[model samples]
Target: MVRRRLVGAVRSVFNDTARGERPVQPSDEALFAPDTPIRLVHADVTAMMVGGVAALLMQALHPRALQGVLDHSNFREDMLGRLRRTARFIAVTTYAHRDEAEAAIARVDAIHARVTGTMPDGSRYAAQEPGTLAWVHIAESWCFMEAHLRYVRPDMSPADQDRYFAQSGLVARKLGADPVPDTRSEALALIARYRPDLRGSPDARETARIVLAGTSRKPAERALHRLLGEAAVDLLPGFARKMLGLRRPLLTSLPTRAATGMLANTMRWAFGR
Candidate 1:
């Protein structure tokens, strides 16, 4: 009963009951093959939680991306809902059947088609821009891999890591990301190339605060969320932390990692992973 409740609680956080989202079952016809690195990296709920936050921080540093979110998304009022939708999209694209995955991609593409606006500097931005989409994709995929390595599998093989990028790039390409990297070196190089375009605007800082502030109300859950948020910040690169106005205190890093590792183990146990 305890295990069931734990699993149900996690599902509740990731799935929107009003929209009738249940747990996504793995299918034989999923986009990637079984036992692939993408599946393993994306399967860890706890690590993904940490990585997702870090990814958002990195993505927000892109002015066009930040402007797009500020203009089109109700993220300020519905942070949890936005996160839930993103988690659902990742789950669907990673584990659901190819047809389902393609449909999800189509839905996002349709939304991107409509997400266009002007930035504060009189620069226009569109969600469908290849370079912008590429930044978003690389930020997210790299952060997810970093979290998995830190919290779940520190000794993840280089070849497998490259494969993970290659597999994930398939989805990115479908979503119109240009110059998608299929290996670790390429991913790092791509990020370096895009670094000049990233900025820590005031709006970006506020969005980062909202993301780290979390949306939980229960005291225990809130405390856990805080710990996860700290770990997520710690997982970010020093440059990114500086860009997002996040500091990684030398004092809490170790304790936060230990606590988050414990939570990851607990979650793996609950899900029979």
Candidate 2:
């Protein structure tokens, strides 16, 4: 019965992403095959959720990015709707047929075209801009891999990491993020390079609160939501932690790890094998 409920919860998280999307089915041979690095890297549902939230928080560290989200997104009224859209895009582009992936990218690109406006200082920000897109892309890929390393597979080889970074660039480039990094070191350098431009603001904090405030109708699922939220905070970069004022006590490490493992294993079991 526990497994049955877990199966439903996990399915809702991913399958529902396609709710309002134009259907995109995977080919017999999807973009990433079963044993490919991309498949191996992103197959864990729990790690993806934990890392995805961490990435969202990290992305908002950029003032312009946060401003763009605040100014344009309907996050207040429909946070889960936003998350489902994002998840759908990722799912279609990564796992679906090439035509489906292209369709998803076209839809996203059209949305991004309208995601432009002026910042407080009168500087302009557009989601499609190279720098802005790169930041979002890198933050997402970095956090997802970080979560995979910590919770799903601690022993992920360095070469595999490099390949994952390199291959992920395919999607990033498609999204118009030029000069995406090709290796782990470059990925870290990309983050470091943007430090001067990244900082916490009221927008960032508010977004974090909204992300953490995700509640489930089912009581069993509420614990899982909190676990993912806390794990996201714990896995964030020290600078990110400081920016968001999310400090993790040293004593919480073991407990955090234990909860994360449970979440990961539970999802894996529910999904099978």
Listed in order, each prediction's TM-score against the native is: 0.98, 0.93
Off by over 4 Å in 1: none
In the predicted model 2, the residue pairs found to clash are none
RMSD of each: 0.8, 2.1
lDDT tens readout by residue for model 2, 177-231: 9769989899999999998988788778878888887845677667777778889
lDDT (Cα, tens digit) per residue for candidate 1, span 1-273: 999999999999998888888999999899988899999999999999999988999999999988899999998889889988899999999999999999999999999999999977797889999999999999999999999999999999999999999999999999999989999899999999999999988888888899999877899988977998899899998998998889999998999999999999999999998
Model 2: CA > 4 A from native:
1-4, 17-28, 215-218
Q: Give the top-scoring candidate (TM-score).
A: 1
Give the range where candidate 1 is weakest over 10 consecutive residues by summed lDDT: 117-126
